[model samples]
Target: MTLSTVNPDFWKGRRVLLTGHSGFKGAWAALWLCRMGAEVTGVSLPPEGNFSLYDSIKDQLTLNSNFIDIRDAEKLNAVVKKSNPEIILHMAAQALVRRSYREPVNTYETNVMGTANLLEAMRDLAELKAALIITSDKVYRNNEDGHAFRETDPLGGDDPYSASKAACEITTASFAKSFFNDKGIPIATARAGNVIGGGDFSEDRLIPDIWRAAREGESVTLRYPGATRPWQHVLESVSGYLVYLQALAGDDGAHLPKSLNFGPQGGEVVTVGEIALEVQKAFGIDSNWSLVNSAQPPEKSYLALDASLAHKALGWQSKWAPSETLTKTVEWYKAFSETPDIYSFTLSQIDEYEDIS
Candidate 1:
């Protein structure tokens, strides 16, 4: 049951409506779809700091850019209705956990209610073939144990952001059962572990902070020094999402409307200290990264995902090992800073990913 790599013609001329097209993962996914020849309509807020990759590739995409928040149901519905997209990839959310501690209300509203708004809007859309809602691996209740959280495990979260994502999982499930189930539009939710990649300018994430500090020749600060997590490059998770959609569309009854986690194989779980060491090796930097707040906050102890379901069901397995993940990520940022045709470089990566089969 090996899954085939995505066919470029599968996306050729397909209508794709992508939310959060300005964010790191969203921008990458949008560029990938565009390179596959999809007509992309990007809906997102203006980039806060640097120019988004979506903006960099705007001229190359047949896109209708919408500057609107997903929390606004009216605007969300209008955009989806007007675009009349064939595929909906909902990636917009308040994604930072530490920032959630500061803006709890905004985090809950965006992750939970924003998902609700997206589902409600697409309920009546006749043209939509599939919808993939992105959640986080933190949606599981963490007991600080070493057990890998399964999809059937109880969904709970200690912090605002994690809880909001958990709520989104619940909301998506309810919507699928109550509305989208018998309506022919396939709705699925994806919960993947922490995604590390280039082009991520967000605060409170490890890889970007490491990249920033290394680029400036400074040491990085770590909050949870000993915490272990299932880390993979962003493309791993996004590829899983695209594969899930392809499975749903091609087999019709092959995929159930349930939540799935995309992560690396067993034994790939590495601690924060180990990853920091790897990043230092990758960057050719020899320096000490300070550990702050020795007394750990209420963070997960060990988090990983069992991607066997994805393997057996979709024949999808992570191709980029941890070292390759780090190498490719760091290389992208370095190249992006100097590359004149950034869009071509970005699209070229998508072409490479698609050609891997």
Candidate 2:
């Protein structure tokens, strides 16, 4: 599905309620929705750092935004009631693994209970046609083998962040079956792989860490250099979400599945070390990385997702290969480092991505 083929009339004048609009992926989704002429209401906490994509584009686009935590059920419900949104895209969560180890209770409360609160609030909105709950690919149990995970794979997580997301999947399923399934509102959960993009200064992530190290004139540190993961551009995953939401809006929950995975193809899987080297070369920096020989929380050494279900069902496929993904990501950061107009640069990239299809 190319960008030209996407019907603009479908999203024009559509009311969308997006959670976590201040974060990396959420900000990208909000930008695309705004370009499509959707009336957007964003609910999320304030930006974690001084440099944020949300800050760059907030004034450029007209949107209804609130700085509220998802755990605040009373305020969240009130916002949802006031927005009267037709579509809900839930992306708010405690997304880091290392931080989860230090604050497990906070992770669970935000990921699991926060999801429940959103769904509960949506139950009364008669105009809501579809709700897509965004979860992580870490929800699957990893045996360190090379087998790619399927939708039917056993749901398990060793870390608090992953476990909380797994519990969210369960909660979304239960809510779908008990409440929305019969009420004519389609609720589905999306699990996406490791997403890399520009303007993401989140700590403990690969791309941001590499950019930081390069700026500081230091070598990049890797805790798990040899671990393999499915890597794709942020736009790829967000495109999949838009396609899934379009399907739900058109069908009204008649034939779509409850859960789907949006990830790279089989050949796009690469190791952490490979990503570091590729980014280094892309940014014209020397390759300098050292392995950390210290204790860290347990994480999967090998992880990948089988997106054949999404392909056969929704005609969704990743357009960018691993190498191209790296190049585009580095290019974005390099442009930002050289130019002051990040909002225009980002919109240009989005326009370029839309023309690719």
Candidate 3:
């Protein structure tokens, strides 16, 4: 099972509908697809904050941008009908755990029903060949047992965000069984671990917090410093999605995996505190962290994913090692500040990644 590198020939002139095109991972996916010559149509809410990655690179992306709430079924359906996309990459959702706690209704309405809306919109689109729903690694029924989760593990979520994603997985499965599979549309879900990369300035994330604190000459506060997580570069996870999507495009639904995990290999366990130190060192700064917290929400203490399924099925393995992931991610942020032409600089990184394969 040799999973080939993403083929520009396969993506060239392909019609793609990418949801959540303004978010961190969505922006990266849009960039990659646009570079590979896909006719991309993006559907997402406006990118927020003063330093949104999508805003910085939107001018560089050659795609049709549609600002619509996924929760609004009618509008989303209308957009999907007008675009008539062949492939749908459903990445739109309320993705923050802390935010989910505060806005449970919005989280459920978006992550759960929002996903349902996308599939429902595409129910009759004969042009749609395949769809890959992006979910999170936190969907497992983790009791801090220190065992890495596999595709068949029991799905559970203590938090609103993870629970909604788990529900999304179920919704996607039901749609496939009831409609899409019979229509020969290959639908699959990918559960990926935590990703660290450049151009991500979201609040409450480790890398952004470290970068912000260092810029202000302050110490980063860590609420879950002792927790262990499986972390990889954002490119690793995104590349896995593209490769998996390519496979689905070439195959029928029956024999392929319905769900899979994209994560780091074994022995990549790194704690939050360790990551903070490593990121600081990568940025050429001293490690300064505070272990104090005020009303930090509940999260998993130990999280890992067994990606052997992705390897054995698609022959996909992580390209960048842990240290290399840290270095390259830091390099991107540094270049974002120093390099005036951030678009070319970002594309250069993508070119470098493709060259690695």
Model 3 bad stretches (over 4 Å): 1-3
Candidate 1 lowest-lDDT run of ten: 249-258
The candidate 3 region of ten consecutive residues with least summed lDDT is: 247-256
lDDT of 2 at 324: 82
| lDDT of predicted model 2 | 0.88
For candidate 2, write residues 17-83 as lDDT tens digits. 9999989999998888898999999999998976788998888776799999899999999999999
The TM-score values for the models, in the order shown, are 0.94, 0.97, 0.98
**Index of the highest-TM-score prediction:** 3
Instruction: Please say which candidate is ahead in lDDT: 1 or 3.
Output: 3
Candidate 3 lDDT, 153-231, residue by residue in tens? 9999999999999999999999999998887889999998898899888878999988988788887789899998889
Clashing residue pairs in candidate 3 (N, C-alpha, C atoms within 3 angstroms)? none
lDDT of 1 by residue, 1-357 (tens): 666566677788989889988788988888788777898888887766654566676677656779899888999899999889888888999998888888999999999998899899988888888888999999998886778888888999999999999999999989988997787667888988778877787877787788788878888889886888889988888898888877776655335536778898773788888888888777777887888755544677688887777787678888778887888777777777788887777766666656665
**Cα lDDT, all candidates:** 0.81, 0.88, 0.89
Q: After superposition, how far is residue 295 of candidate 1 from its true place, in Å?
A: 7.6
Give the TM-score (vs. native) of candidate 2.
0.97
